[model samples]
Target: MSEGDRDHSTGSGRLVTGAAWAALLLGLWLWGTEVTDVRHGLSVPATGDMAAVGRPAAAELPPAAAPLKDARPRRIDIPSLRVQAPVMPRGLDDRGGIDPPPYARSGVVGWYAAGARPGAAGAALFVGHVDTEDRPAVFHGLGAMRTGETVRVFRDDGTVAEFTVDDVQVVGRDRFDARQAYGVRQSGRAELRLITCGGTFDRASGTYTANVIVSAYLTGTGP
Candidate 1:
């Protein structure tokens, strides 16, 4: 195998550490900022500018909707990707990284229980696996989602928060910015972030080279 090819492996295993997501967890602690940066909205980086990777030139997104009361998420649906999955609360692991759903539950998505609740006035974070040992996972097609799409989060209060896709990025390991990636894009707006492993898998490192981040803002609501 060539130099880069040497990193190729035959099977997919539980690969979580070395992920750029750790930066997000660390950022939360060091920045002393709320999960959504209550003071202000975090802007996207200009240097790597991965925000519009899958956005269409003519996509016209809707304006942000009024923030809603806090409610725990029960499920998530991405109509475009045909992704409908359960949302389970997850906390940090011993290593301080997000302890996502177990590998066996790849179809389930994990929500940061301690952070902003979905439909609330903050950034609600959802994470899932891209793939497993022999099958594609819940977020396998996440990177293909484009701007102007929609993500629906069903809340325990019997309402659905409808979000409009505004940013989709494939942030590489070297350029991962926790604040920019996970921080709220607009103050007072209910935001959502769906994250998963992306880019080429490195067998040698047992991790992916990047993370696919899908950013959306609440634009409407439903019963």
Candidate 2:
């Protein structure tokens, strides 16, 4: 080949290689930035739908030998997870939908009143923010929970309901399946669904791409 043609070919190869390296570097930077944002809880979604296994049928719980309305959850404790917080009656806000509070100091442990009660026949729904304004909040360490861990719910009626973790899974926020998270259920047993934000974060939108849900079932109860 002529000297001029050889020189041109070599220059083009270098240009292509440099462009490829630049693209790779850009992708790594974006990925790292996303991870940082998620760790800080800056871009995670503020709300998510609970997924369940099956739809619960409408049936009255067996009459307690004693009335136990006073036994509703008042505080939640997970010793292995180092979580201890008072339960609040977190119902629908003015928007008429279930959403976790934006602030950590809200001190609200939300409950899906539309779902079943603890120790009832259906899955009881609970949602909380992992963090807010970069401050750790309730359920912050929820992602670290493993199967067999115990979650204690202290009912107002002085009864403590204990639940054993069954599984934890992460699903995309846009693909969150509420029925699979909060509706499906088995017979004669109460279930629990806990949700928080996780997965990749998007700095442009300031939210995570997915949510982490932890499922559990009633193991027993005590005073």
Candidate 3:
């Protein structure tokens, strides 16, 4: 999880093509339970050309609620994963890829402002650091989240949006499909994606071979 080489690492392969990430991940090896749909371990081959695993199609997912008023995500709480972090608005860099939360703010989660809000009528994006050169950060245990678990997001308007885990996938760059990771299957459905660096860390390249992506949809809400 080093990712110390550049701003965002990109390969000609399918991985860097999507807004999922551009090799912007940071960290070292982390040991614990991982959430998944296809495999058990988060480690992928050095080349990262493996097939991707993810949630089912939009038709298979439960429908979404009507879109909510635009409000920034202020906090995110996942009871099962024991993850609670402050949310920060993030925008894309010059390259059009979403900028990851700064390495210094390793404990914070970055919400893509250009994308859909947590309960809005589209795919909402959140990214965080997996780990740093020293130790684990906010999303270190991201892989441990299981299907049917709940992910709660508190917006600035004091409204809370709750989501249910539909799928958890770790996709290698070669097999990375931006459409699957960042696309909105249904135009009016509210979706959420939590992304961080995954797979085995390659010390030689200072980057992971794949990314751990969690997919969920709005299931409930509270004030």
Off by over 4 Å in 3: 1-20, 23-64, 94-96
TM-score winner between 1 and 3, please give it.
1
lDDT, candidate 3, at 205: 56
Model 1 Cα shift for residue 142 (angstroms): 0.4
Best by lDDT: 1
Clashing pairs in 1: none
- Candidate 2's displacement at residue 210, Å, is 1.4
**Residues 1-223, model 2: lDDT tens digits:** 2344335545221111111111111111221111211121111222222322232322322222211232366778888667887765555444344545435343456665545566555566676666554455677677666567788888766788778776566666555544444443444456677766666544444455666767777877788
Least well predicted 10-residue stretch by lDDT in candidate 2: 14-23
Candidate 1 vs candidate 2, TM-score winner: 1
Residue 199 error, candidate 3, Å:
0.7
TM-score of 1: 0.82
Taking the tens digit of each residue's C-alpha lDDT, what string does model 3 give over 2-92? 3433435333121222234663322101101121222323322111212333422233444556667778899999897698999999876
User: lDDT per residue, candidate 1, 85-186, as tens digits?
Assistant: 999999887667887887668899999888888888878889898887677888888887777889999999999999998877776778777777777777
Model 1 per-residue lDDT at 181: 78
